[model samples]
Target: MIELKSAGELDAMRLAGKVVATALRAVAAGAAVGTSLRELDEIAAGVLADAGARSSFLHYQPGGAPSPFPAVLCTSVNDAVVHGIPNGYRLRDGDLLSIDFGAEVDGWHGDAATSFVVGTADQRDLDLIAVTERALAAGIDAARPGNRLGDIGHAIGGIGRAAGYGLLADHGGHGIGRAMHEPPSVPNEGVAGKGLRLRPGMVLAIEPMLVAGGGDSYRPAEDGWTLCTFDGSRAAHAEHTVAVTSDGPRVLTTE
Candidate 1:
């Protein structure tokens, strides 16, 4: 069931959000050419531990194939869309690296992700990331108290469609409060003015994943976690944990 958070609960989520945002910032900064993906995961793990928070993603299993996830940070590069496990692969020029991180504080969860182009980037790659970033902003704007869940999804998905990119349908956003994955699944594509009604104190993690080749299909990696585009096209993902507020959408993931 979708649950409304109290002010106290919102405050706890805010703290967790900060931890995630800070860690993501540090990881992105260190994602230079030649940096190992595993190294970035270690950096994020230390940051979460130092903040006295725990990873919402580490060792997490969500009705998948094998065991729990091994890494705290998701290092999705190039055609890899989401849940890209960190490994010994090193960053390279023109690589579209998407890092997704989640942290828990006092049981509340914060989740966010960002895509970065290592060294240099191609025009198509830059456009993918830019559109995904703008899509996230559109979703946040639509997460108002009176808006329906479809409004948020429509806003996000519309941008990718306008950009001629393919929106991943299977994996979308979700309501996030005490748990990493909660009720009110937030899709990247939907009709506006449809779906559940938004209420104040409802926290959600809105993420938009897009593929450059105008195809939405994806295949699971052999690791049983990472999802990559079927057409071998580059992809980008952007996300933020936000709260529906009376004044407006309160973005909890910030510096």
Candidate 2:
């Protein structure tokens, strides 16, 4: 069932959201050529620990998963789309890195992700990241009380499709609160004024994943956790947790 958070609960959630934003910022600043993905994960873990928070992804076993997630953060590089487990691989110049992280504070959860270029980035790479960020911003702007969930998706899809980027329909956004995932799944592509109606007290994680090539994706190696593009084309993902309020959509996960 979908739970509407009370004002007090929303405040608690903001705390968690702040921690997520801080963690992502730290990871992004540390991400550079010659930096290891594992080191990035460690940086996030330390931030969460110092804040007295817990990792929402650690040991998180989704349905049909063989085992729980092992890492505190997901470090997807280049062609890797999402859920890229941290490894010993060192980043290289011109590599695009996507970092996804979540935090649980006082039992409330917040999830966010950002994509960045490691070193000297190509124009195509920079453009892809900029478009993805713009798409996410559009989606968040569409999220307000009384707006349909489809409005959010449509906003994101419009930008992505117009850019000739493939929209991955498989994985999308979701309602997030006490749990990492909640009711009312938010797809990246949909018709405005359709699906669940947005209302005050509803919080959601709006994410847009765009691929430079066709939107086709596949599981990486035997890890079962990492997802990558089938054609090896670079991908970008951007996300933010927002809350629908009487005034408008308030972004909770901000520095």
| C-alpha root-mean-square deviation, each candidate | 0.8, 1.0
Question: Which residue runs of candidate 1 sit more than 4 Å off their true CA positions?
Answer: none
TM-score of 2: 0.98
lDDT by residue for model 2 over 1-255, one digit each (tens)? 889988899899999999999999999999988989999999999999999999999999999777799999999999888998999999999999999999999899999999999989999989999999999999999998888998999999999989988876588999999999998788898899898999999999999999999565655647888888888899999999899998888888987
lDDT by residue (131-196, candidate 1, tens digit) is 999999999999999899999989988999999999885889999988899998999988999999
lDDT of 2 at 118: 91
Worst 10 residues of 2 by lDDT: 214-223
Which regions of candidate 2 deviate over 4 angstroms?
none
Candidate 2 lDDT = 0.91
